[model samples]
Target: MNRDDGPLFGGRAWLPALLIVPMFLGFAFLGVQGGTVIGTLTLAAVVVWAIRANPEGPIEIAAPGEGVRGGVLVVLLAPIDDPPVAGVLAAITDPSRREAGEPLLLAPTRIGRLDRFFGDIEAARFESQRVLAVSVATLAAAGIEVEGRVGDDDVVLAAEDTLRTYAATEVVVFAPGEDDDGAIAKLERRLGIPLRRID
Candidate 1:
């Protein structure tokens, strides 16, 4: 339906009556006795004011699909770093120079933390949850609230289809460097919607 169809009132028309009662109280306080000229005028003024104030109803957020209005969705991607920390360090002999060599594979942070806490099923899930929490925290710190819709998952062609199905107005993607570039290209090709990368 078009916006001109009076906004799908859904019982909002009674709002004016609600305001008129308050106006009557205000009029009584103003020494306008028993709903007379001044009292009636006050009530009319309030009703008009109330009618003009159009408040919107809340919309629900759901998975992307056809016939549903999708909202802005943000997806964050974190890739593993190469030669992670805690690697081997080569030191010098007493009189010689120090030589640096290949890093010893450090115990994975996700593994260490996961073993310390969740006791294992999938370490990847643990890391994903950790990253999602971090992403939310970072976004909030930067004054960007994820009020509309936000999700975390492996973004693929199906993900793009889901986004289009839900008819999202805005899609926020969090990919770093080359990953972000790749995501944008894929989204552009598949959804034909503009992809905005957040630093």
Candidate 2:
């Protein structure tokens, strides 16, 4: 879900109510047989719409051509100090060819379910900022320049949002562990651009 669209049914609370009101009206006016049919059909429609609007679904991204010189977008899934930063640096900068500009480091806010429900994301944002700070400082100390920004809670959504403004030829994800194979595969299929994962 793009931030602009808000959370599922966030601002558009009226939509579900609108669909539900007709069912009760049918129950009051029509016979049980007719009301049951209407209610079932309405429920089915809602289910279909929800599935279609799912944020986990693949997003459309432009593929960069091979050997193109462009910016790199680095997504940091965990805070890194030194050891992991070396791997991240290796993934973003190729010894064979020079990249276009400073890599953009994005850290997604990882909020808990309860925090998200209550719209209290300050802690999550702070954590993400800290991740970016540590990663950026580590990279800088290693003599590599980077730009950092906090992203959306969902990694895919964060990457998609970054790509809108950053002309990235490749994307590098710094996952905490090798267990993120499923997420890496999903990103590879959806991002379209070249992707490298460092765990």
Candidate 3:
């Protein structure tokens, strides 16, 4: 099938489509409009699913005093350990910007079933959050004051949201050393800001 003809449902559309076979068989046994009802409901469901699967528009965040603190938005991906806090801090041009405190936003993408079919999605999400929490504590122990928030896995959106919310004048993306440079570059372009990286 062409990309345009692909199912609109998120995840596996094949699962639901397979159910149609059993549904038809069962509905036939029930007699009368039962089969028709089942078919209608299934078709309606697919339509609704397609509509919802469409990507949402960009989000906007509001901050007080127009980010008077001169905050820096940090978007950290998973496996964040010993995050070069000092180096990151020293890289900032002005000491005054640090006064308001840098806000670290962890936005780890969930491992999809394609990557690990037997793994639990919730477990993956929680693990990412846990990693972010540990990174936050590590930074705090290093005497680098930071405010933290766990955000969506989409780095582009996460960076944008954090920057607006924190009123950050600059952005730093802490990604795994092995991550795709192309993706990182794309994210920077989307944010309209050249992201400083530490990894």
Candidate 4:
């Protein structure tokens, strides 16, 4: 963010309540009483769990204490705001090309089938697919492996969950544009694991 933007946003604390008001009002005003009560309670509980579970800043994980040969280095590539799954696919196929060879693992974190179908139409899909295909032919050119998955409640939360599950030693990231700090901060908090932001 530009230094001139000041504190970025105000009332960061009440922001959730403000956003949820519409949902609350809509449920209450257009009631089917029993269903509304159950749904509202469920929504509120999830919101609380999600917020309480995330971290809140940029992370810088230390190098692994174990031998490099035995350690597992993971990179959680967040989805592109522009919605091109290919970079993700390509990155997963080979992340070592980036910043001193960060042993890339393309984390699958995206919407359901509807989004994937729509994705096939994007030009980025072609570019990513092209890069992915070529990268396969030239695995010796760069050592990278990619695997995909979907249905991470939140990519950040899912990434964090994976980290703990895998006991990852270090994490690498592909940040979207220049100064996308808020999104970065949200991930840091959600994952609670520090990360190194890669270009």
Q: Residues 40-145, candidate 2, lDDT per residue (tens digit)?
A: 9999987887777655544544344554324778888887786556655755564444653547788989888999999999999999999999988887777677
For each candidate, the alpha-carbon lDDT, in order, equals 0.42, 0.75, 0.60, 0.45
Model 3 lDDT tens row, 1-199 = 3444444543454666685874587587865577777777777876787677744333333454843443566667654456465445445523465433455555555566564676556776777778777776766665666656666556666665566656555567676566653656766655543467777
Return the clash pairs for model 1, or none: 65-165, 65-166, 88-104
User: Number of clashing pairs, model 2?
Assistant: 0
lDDT ranking, best first: 2, 3, 4, 1
Global Cα lDDT for candidate 2: 0.75
TM-score of 4: 0.37
Task: Tell me model 1's lDDT, rounded to 2 decimals.
Answer: 0.42
Alpha-carbon RMSD to native, per candidate:
20.0, 6.9, 9.0, 12.2
TM-score between model 1 and native:
0.36
Q: For candidate 1, lDDT tens digit of each residue in 10-39?
A: 446665466567557666775556546655
For every model shown, the clashing-pair count is: 3, 0, 0, 5
Q: Which candidate leads in lDDT?
A: 2
Cα deviation of 181 in candidate 3 (Å)? 8.0
Error of 4 at 154 (Å): 2.7
Q: What is the lDDT of residue 182 in candidate 2?
A: 69
Which candidate, 2 or 3, would have the higher lDDT against the true structure? Answer: 2
Query: Candidate 1: misplaced stretches above 4 Å?
Result: 1-69, 79-121, 147-154, 161-165, 180-183
lDDT of 4 by residue, 1-199 (tens): 3433223223255555555665667667766775477667767875776666533433333344454321233333443333233344345434454332334343434344675677543443444444334434343333334332332425465554454434444455555455333544566554534456654
- In candidate 1, how many Å is residue 107 off? 24
